[model samples]
Target chain A: EAEVAQSPRYKITEKSQAVAFWCDPISGHATLYWYRQILGQGPELLVQFQDESVVDDSQLPKDRFSAERLKGVDSTLKIQPAELGDSAMYLCASSLTGTGVSYEQYFGPGTRLTVT
Target chain B: TQLLEQSPQFLSIQEGENLTVYCNSSSVFSSLQWYRQEPGEGPVLLVTVVTGGEVKKLKRLTFQFGDARKDSSLHITAAQPGDTGLYLCARQGGSNYKLTFGKGTLLTVNP
Candidate 1:
């Protein structure tokens, strides 16, 4: 089975430092998602991208958090001046399509970020 | 904001016991999905219940969508230690591009 891939499985950074996570979706999947999960809470969507275009980012903390899918196949999520509240598990998921009855998302192992 | 509420935020049971987790929402959903997440890993899709009053079975797991389409349940029969994980339910509210997820139910099945 083709799995979604993520990098820097674990990270620890001082407050105000920068951190970035990478994800490569399954080949040909058109939709990618970035979600942040605080300990003991569900994953909250940070952004969604469809073929290099952002579909939704209403919940994204625009000031210091940004995500991009430059080519629409692989994606990067960056945080500048990370804060203590930014400590969480960042997850990446992808689906073959963002529509229809087959819109099941496959998730990567996820990147755990700790901002002290 | 659309909200999904999952019940029994935490559950613990002995192996071979039965358990059920629920997800409820006030906003109607076009589709509902259940996912399981292990420690240090992202969630994996378990099942999707789309229609009102629909029931689907996968091995020892059974899923049911409420008649009103705003609630769903997952029942695991003869649960095992391997079934210990976080169970999340999500739905597409206004569009397919966005998903609203419920605070998951954490299940711990001890052997």
Candidate 2:
């Protein structure tokens, strides 16, 4: 089965430094999502992209975080001047269709980020 | 967006024991999903319940969607050590079909 792929399974960074994580969704998937999972907490949506275009980012801290899916296949999430509270698991998910209740998302093995 | 609340935030049981976790919401869901996550890994989709009063079974696990579509439950029969993980309930809504998840129930089945 095809699976979403993420890079740098673990990362450690100093506060005020910059960090980036990458994700490649399963082929043919049009919708991609970025989520942050705090320890013992449910994952929260950071951004959603549809065919290289952003669909929703209201929950994203635009001042410090930015995500892009330039070609609509793979995506990158970046945080400049990372904060200690920013430490969490970064998950990437993809779905074949961008809409509907029937579509289920497939998740990648997330990147674990830690800020010191 | 809808908020999902999962009950029994943490559960520990011996192998062969059974347990149930619940998910509730004030807002109705068009559909709901259950996922399992091991430490250091992303959540993996287990089941999706679309209709109210729907029930689906996967191996030794059973999932039920309430008649009102505002709640769901997962029951594990004869749990095993392999069942140890985080159980999360999720729903998709909004114009973009954004997915929202509950805090999750952490289950540890001791051998």
Candidate 3:
């Protein structure tokens, strides 16, 4: 079966360093999302992209976090000068359309980032 | 902000037992979804309830959407070891494609 793909299943970085994670959504999916999950907590949305345009990023820490889906297929989420508090599982999900009401999201095995 | 709350943060039961997990919110959603996530892996969708008061069944699992679309429930009958995992409920937020997820119910079925 087709599934969302993510890279660097595990990452370890020091404080004040930069880190990046990548995701490739299922074929023909138009909506992509990035989320962060601390241990024992639910995943929280960070950014959302509808094709190549950002539809919701209000939850993203813009000062240090950035995400982009240039071709609307694969996406990259970057954190500049990462902090210890940034250690968490970064998940990527995609849906068939931009409207969440119509389709179910498919998630990829997340990148577990640990900032020391 | 719209938020979903899941009850019974953790559940441990013997095989053949019956259990139910709940998801509630103050905000109504256009649709609600249930997912199961195994350790070190992503969540997999189990069911989606769109209409109010809808009920869907998958094998030994039964899902119900509240009459007001603000709550949902998942019931499992004769649970087995394979049923152990984290159960999450997510809803589509207002006028947005982003999903608001509940903290989730961690279930451990002892065989």
List lDDT for all candidates, in order.
Answer: 0.91, 0.93, 0.92
Order of models, best lDDT first? 2, 3, 1
Candidate that would win on DockQ: 2
Per-candidate TM equals: 0.96, 0.96, 0.94
Off by over 4 Å in 3: A98-101
Question: What's the lDDT of the predicted structure labeled candidate 2?
Answer: 0.93
Candidate 1 backbone collisions, by pair: none
True contacts kept of each: 0.75, 0.89, 0.81
Clashes of each: 0, 0, 0
Candidate 1 - CAPRI tier? medium
Across residues B1-111, which tens digit of lDDT does each residue of candidate 2 receive?
Answer: 568999999999999999999999998988999999998888999999999999999999999999999999999999999999999999977788878899999999999
What DockQ would you assign to candidate 2? Answer: 0.85
Per-residue CA lDDT of model 2 for A71-102, tens digit only, reads 88899999998999999999999998833444
Candidate 1 deviant stretches above 4 angstroms: A98-102
- Candidate 3's residue-wise lDDT over B42-90, tens digit each? 8889999999999999999999999999999999999999999999998
The most accurate candidate by TM-score is: 2
Q: How far out, in Å, is residue B49 in model 1?
A: 0.7
Tally clashes: model 2.
Answer: 0
Clash pairs, candidate 2, are none
